[model samples]
Target: MSASDWQKSSYCGEGESCIHIAHAAVDHTVRLTESGDPAGVILSATPHAFAALLDAVKENHA
Candidate 1:
């Protein structure tokens, strides 16, 4: 997906550390810090990889 299409995560809840995500064009998901401009560097990964990352974060937090 285009970087222009990514929206900040709703879970961010007005925080500065939020991340933006988009699935508007490509099958791969893109992520970037909300504090950066839309043109900022983005990390791309498959949905499964992203899910695994989330799971790892949850596990670490728990």
Candidate 2:
């Protein structure tokens, strides 16, 4: 993704090593990376997989 495509997580504060996500340039996948390590490994997930991950996280909190 380009510089303008990646969006920071709204829940993060300034200077935090948070995660960022961007829509894939040419596919139906989400791209994830750390703000502090932009050039590091980029994890990709389908829409369904991403939703399942969020569901699991929410369930853990509940």
Candidate maximizing lDDT:
2
lDDT values of the candidates? 0.65, 0.78
Per-candidate TM-scores read 0.61, 0.82
**For candidate 1, lDDT tens digit of each residue in 1-62?**
35567677777766556788765344555465455356554666777887898899999999
Model 2 lDDT vs. the true structure?
A: 0.78
Query: Best candidate, TM-score-wise?
Result: 2
lDDT of 2 at 48: 93
Global local distance difference test of model 1: 0.65
